[model samples]
Target: MLAPFLIMLREGLEAALIVGIIAGYLRQTGRGHWLPAVWIGIFLAVALSLFTGAAIQLLATGFPQKAQELFEALIGLLAVAVLVGMVFWMRRVARSIRTELHASVDAALAGRDGAAWALIFMVFLATAREGLESVFFLLAIFQQSPSAAAPLGALLGLLAAVAAGWAIYAGALRLDLRRFFRWTGVFILFVAAGLLAGSLRALHEAGLWNSLQQVVFDLGRVLPESSPFGTVLSGLLGYREAPTLGEVIVYIVFLAITVPLFLRPQPAARLGRVTDV
Candidate 1:
């Protein structure tokens, strides 16, 4: 539940931020009339995301057990890849996103011919990227944990993101986006590592991966995933009471490789920018 919540929150917030920046730029430059076009693009992008998620869910329900496992494994792998890419991409663009967005807005509105269409397409592409990322992550989470709470958490997270975005846009809130993203990026890396391990487990269950089948340790007696605390840990950190050797190894290796690179000091070229939003 917590994992889905945080993932959705981060993804939704990123989209909201993009929309806010575009809207803000348009208003600041006396192009507020373009706001309607922006809204249209957002609506279309959101519809597409919802339709895609629903279609995938319906299709997965009809698959055989092994096929289901394989599908889940594939979704988990895709989610991890998308999550990792999103974290790094945001880090790389955080410093210049505002400037780049402003420039894009200028370009979109530069031509009188189909200027509104250009702006709509620009906004659609930006928001759709974030929306599609959220859809994949949410699907992976839902597949792993089939509980009512997970969807509720995702809804809450998205609502919170919308509120936060509105507050920021209305000048009612001042958040340190740099610190927010930095810490969340670290948190997400852990989440992605867990998802990666879970994906490997899914693959093994699907009969597609059989190596490293030895059990690492049995904590089921001491900390069963069914326990309340253990469940929380599992939801947040992908904790497994009796993890296989491969799962443990992959989990550790993933963190070892990603944590340092993520925490390393940014290059000067990526620093010294106002990223308050």
Candidate 2:
């Protein structure tokens, strides 16, 4: 539940920020009429994202047991890849994202010929990228622990993000988005580590990975997963009371490597503050 919440919160906020930036730019440049095109593009991107997720879920349900495990394992790996890429890329691009977005919009509006198409395409691509990223990340979480709470948490996170984005756009909120993204990026790295371990477990179950099947240590008695705290741990951290040797090794190794990398600061850039200018 916590995993999906954080994932969607971060991703949703990103989409909202991008749209806000675009809309803000249009209004400031006396191109408010293009605002409707932005909304249309957002709607199209969202619809595509929903359709893709539904198709994938419906397709996955028809698979046999082992095949299903393999599919989950594959999706988990893919999600982890996307999550890691997004985290690092955001760090690198954060300082200059506004400028890049503004440039893109300017280019789109440079000529009247196909101007609407250009605007819609630009916003659609940006938003769809964020949406698809969320879909994969959330799918991996659901695969780890299927429940109503996870989806609900994600939905709420997205709603909160939209509200917060609106507030920011209206100049009613001043957020340290730099700090927010940094912290959430760290949180996501840990979550991705757990998912990586979980994926290995799934691969083992699917018979694609057979070695290291031995139980490393059993903690079922002290903290059974059926218990409340255990359930929370399992959902958030992928804590298996009696995890296999492979799972334990992957989990430990992943955090050990990624955490340090995440902590290292990037080279400073000479970018200005976030603004519609």
lDDT of 2 by residue, 119-166 (tens): 999999999999999988888898888888899989988988889888
lDDT of 1: 0.90
Question: Where in model 1 is the C-alpha error above 4 Å?
Answer: none
The residue-level lDDT of candidate 2 at 245 comes to 86
Error of 1 at 162 (Å): 0.3
Winning candidate number (lDDT): 1
Give the poorly placed runs of model 2, Cα more than 4 Å off.
270-277
Please give, for residues 179-275, the per-residue lDDT of candidate 1 as tens digits.
7888899999998998899999999999999999899999999999999999888888899999999999999999999989998998887784435
